[model samples]
Structure formats: structure tokens, C-alpha cells
Target: MKTDKTIRTHIVFSIAIVASALLEPCANASSIVGTKHDLSSYTNSSGQICIACHTPHNAQADQLVPLWNHAATTTQFTLYSSVTAKSVPGQPTGYSKACLSCHDGTLALDSFGGKTPAGAGKISGANNLGTDLSDDHPVSFTYDTNLATAHPGIVSPASAAFVDTAKTVPLFNGKLECSSCHDAHDNQNTFFLRKSNAGSALCLSCHNK
Candidate 1:
């Protein structure tokens, strides 16, 4: 027969085992790495996901893209503007341009790794954002306190509430871009949003409304 102390130790060990199992990382099926973003359809492929967007060596030296394997978009976009919008947006830069390289639907999805396939693959369906961005949310815009002051609905990116919070909207070089609202690598949230927008939680993080 076990003593009371032995019974307690057994219970504690069982609880620890359960807790570790619960803490283990589960497979994310919706993540971009293995989803449709994985360019396995193209010829001369090694079946590597990161190869679609990145290479270990001989990457473009001039672009800001990290080890970029794909060609950057040259299409000029019609930016979003509104009478109430305080921020002045420029041409898409940084990750926004990287995202548009395929999303703009002008370039082939398989046109990467310093090779352009014949009749190269292209983005279709609702995912295609195209070059005309007048309807989409404005990107590549500085989102500093000045803009927040000009537009009372927005919270400053520098504020402690946003930066220090667990649910934070990311900015690129003090600017709001496509990656700000979306996380291409993780899709635990719908639409690859960095956090759940349920009840407008993500929107309210940046917008006071």
C-alpha cells in the first residue's frame, strides 16, 4: 500500500505530464510554409518551401527583402487616400513590395530562384490584389504620433499601450505596411492576422474606434 506522500507525488507527476503535453506546439496546417504558398507545381524544383521566397546565397543585394529569391514588382500602384486620412503613403516598399511581387498577379508564383518559367505561374482568385491599390488599405505609410494626432481614431504606434501590450500591431521602420496587420508565417488567426480580430480586438489595438 502507498503512503499519503507517495500518492501526492504520483498525482503531481501525472499533472506535470499532462501540462507538458498541453504546452507542446501543434501543427499549423494553415501556415504559409506548407499551404498553397508552397510552389511544388513548378518544374526543376527541390520541393522546398522557403526556396519560393528565399535562397541561402547569391540573393539580390540591393533590395531590402531578406535573401529574396523572387523578382520584385515594378508595377506602379494607385495608392489609397481619403479626406480624413492624415498619413501620406508612398510607393510600396519593404515587405509590402515583397508580398505584391506575387499577390499583384502580374508575376508568376513559380518565377523564383533566378529562374523564370515559360508561361510562369500567376496568382488568381481573391488572393490577387493587383497593382491598383486604391480600394485596399493604404500601406507603406508612416504611422507616427503625428498621424495619430491628426487622426484621433488611430493610436500612436509609439504608445506604451500598443508597444508594451501582448497583442501588438507591428510596424516596419515606424511605418504601417502589409505585414503590420498580417503574419505571413503564422495563420493561427484567420487571414494570417497577427492576433485574433474577433470583436475587432486587432483593429481596436490601432484604431480607438
Candidate 2:
């Protein structure tokens, strides 16, 4: 029979092994597990990192949707406006609205899968975009050839159907949305920028200047 000390040592080793298994996935930078988007740390029931944002089935139906897991905020944002701007920006729609579910700072980060105010708290500091968006880059606006032709600052999509010849920067049905610039699942670039903005390369991708 194992002595008391031997039994205690075995239990300690087993617990350490289990803990490592739970954490190793989060250490990998290749996926959402290790990124700032990873909310598995605060969740209690599921170890899945994607569960905070997406669900395979039975997702919220009404808003922030297309199988989105989070509850939508009712905040009517102050969109970017300008007298000289040719693009007629509208209230957040599609993916931009989905992103605002957390970024607008009116909703908690863990309020997902029908769990309102999961006690994980809201995003704060630089990550929080707040309700006022007049100072930010405009989103949820049509970025078609007509708008491109009207504004010297905007670049026309090379293929007309996509933002670039490479189609890396996507337009949702010709509308520029937040996912046009950011990818939530991947963050290899800083702040989840779809591509590096070093020397303003990413900005220049869509902007004429």
C-alpha cells in the first residue's frame, strides 16, 4: 500500500498535469486561444475560446448574429460624419455591429451565449471604443466605385467586387465594415489589424494617399 506522503505527492502531480493541459492551448499565438480575444480564462463552464464569440449551433437569433454568441447592445452610436466626405455613413451594421457588441463598452465581454452580464466585466481602457465614434475611421458605409470616384481620398477596389486584387480587405456587399480592417480570430498583427499598418501600409491599402 502507498504511504500517506506518497499518495499526497501523486495527487499534486496529477493536478499539475491537468492544469497544464488547460493552459497550453492559450499559450499558442497561432489561434484565438492566446490572443486578447481569448475569453476562456474568465469562463466557468466551457474551455472553448470561440464560445465567447461564436457557436456551432443554437446561437442568439435576433442581433449581432449569423450564429453570434453574444447579446447585442442597444446603443445608437455617433458615427463618423464630415461635410466633405462623399461616403454616406450609417449606423453600425453587419460585422461592424457585431464587433460593437463588446467594443462599444456598453456590454460586458463575457455576456455571450444568452448570458447577460456574466460577471466577467466590460472591456476597458484602449480596447473600449465607447459610443462616440466621430473621431474614428468611418464604418458601415458603401465603398463602391461611385463613392470612390466622388472622393479623391478613397481608392476604388481594383476588382470592383472586392477591396483589393488580393481580396484580403473584404467589403460586405460593397459596404465597408469593421471586419474590413480587423480580423477577430487572428491577431498576428498589432490590435488585430488585418494587415500591418507599419508606415501606414494598411491605411494606404484603401486610402488614395
Candidate 3:
């Protein structure tokens, strides 16, 4: 059993490495500027472009987040609020700005600086991610006491508290990201989720429906 598990893990890592290399050229800063092509070609519908998340310089440990080139938007994002808001408000948590930096569609897609061929200019985007995030799912809030009270059956603060700790240790501790539910490299489901069709199935992965 142990050997099988190790082999599976190795296979997954190997596959990820190959996929990332194939998509690296597309991640070049130039493409994000104005080069218009099917962005979906690099990775499956999951939006798992290698350069999009990783970087050549100053990449995260083992290059999980990778050395991304674009500057993440430091501005405070408007988080979802309601009586059911189990987490704190307007703080950077969950996948937070790191994930939204691109999905929000406001910051320059290729804003992350990268080594480009000579004579090439910096990449910039005309599509601004508007302030209205109501259309998208909520992010950047603390999953503390309130969540325990409302959705005690589902969310727990234990994972949220480890965001900083997980970075140096296991690297991932059940935190949510676009990939938390969706697989950016493989478009297998309606929303690129890693499993069966989304909607309730995706929610059920984390929550009890």
C-alpha cells in the first residue's frame, strides 16, 4: 500500500511538471500584454497555465506558487457579507488576493514581470476587473468563530489558522483556492472541478449537503 501511494504521488508530480513546461512559453509576459489567442490552449479549461502561477525568480518553496512575475493587487477587495458571514471581513485569507489577482480580471494578466526576449515590452491588459465582485464567489475573509456558529457542520477555523504555517510545512492545509475545487490543468467538469460535475457535487466535497 505504501509503495502504491508513493508511486501515485510520483506520477502526479511528473505529470504536473510536464504540463507546466508545455505551458511555460505561453506564460511569457508578452502573451499577457496583447497577444490574442485561445488562452485555453496552454492548459485544459482548468486555466492551469504554468507561468500563470509559477515564476523563474523568487518562486515559492518547491515552486508551489512559483516565482510569479505579476504584482498582486494590494488593494482591499470587497468580500461577500451577510448575516451568514462566518469569517472576518475584508482581510486577506482563503486564496484571497493571490487567486483573485488574475481571476478578478482587474490587474494586468501578465502584470507579473518576467524575463523576455530583447526588444520586447512589458505586458499590459486593457480588461480591467471592475470593483463589482458580486458576480464571483466570495474570498479574503477569516473563517473564525462566526463560521463555526453558522455552518458548524462544514467550515472549520482549524484550517484557516494554518495559512501561514502551512507555507513552511506541508505546503497545503485544506485552504481554498480556485484550484481548491477546480483543477486548472484539466477541464473535467462544468467549472473545471477535479471530480464529477459541480453544483452540489463540488459543494459536497467540502460541505455536507
Candidate models: Cα lDDT each: 0.80, 0.80, 0.48
Give the Cα-based TM-score of candidate 2 against the true structure. Answer: 0.80
What candidate 2 gets wrong by more than 4 Å, as runs, is: 1-29, 63-65, 118-120, 158-166
lDDT of 1 by residue, 93-209 (tens): 998999998899988877777776665568888999988999999999998889898898888777887886425478878888898888777766757788889998888888887
lDDT of 3 by residue, 1-209 (tens): 56988999999999999998677555643333212322434334676445555656665332224464445655566655667545444544434455555555545455444422332232335433445554455544434435656776653435553333333212123344445554444442423445664366545444544
- Per-residue C-alpha lDDT of model 2 across residues 13-82, encoded as one tens digit per residue: 9999999867755574557776778889766666778788888888888645567888887889888888
Candidate 1 wrongly placed segments (more than 4 Å) = 1-26, 29-33, 43-45, 165-167
Candidate 2 — worst ten consecutive residues by lDDT sum? 158-167
Order of models, best lDDT first: 2, 1, 3
Lowest summed lDDT across 10 adjacent residues in model 1 is found at 21-30
Error of 2 at 94 (Å): 1.2
TM-score each candidate: 0.81, 0.80, 0.50
Clashing pairs in 3: 46-184, 55-67, 59-67, 69-112, 69-113, 70-111, 70-112, 86-147, 105-129, 106-129
Q: Which candidate would rank higher by lDDT, 2 or 3?
A: 2
Worst 10 residues of 3 by lDDT: 165-174
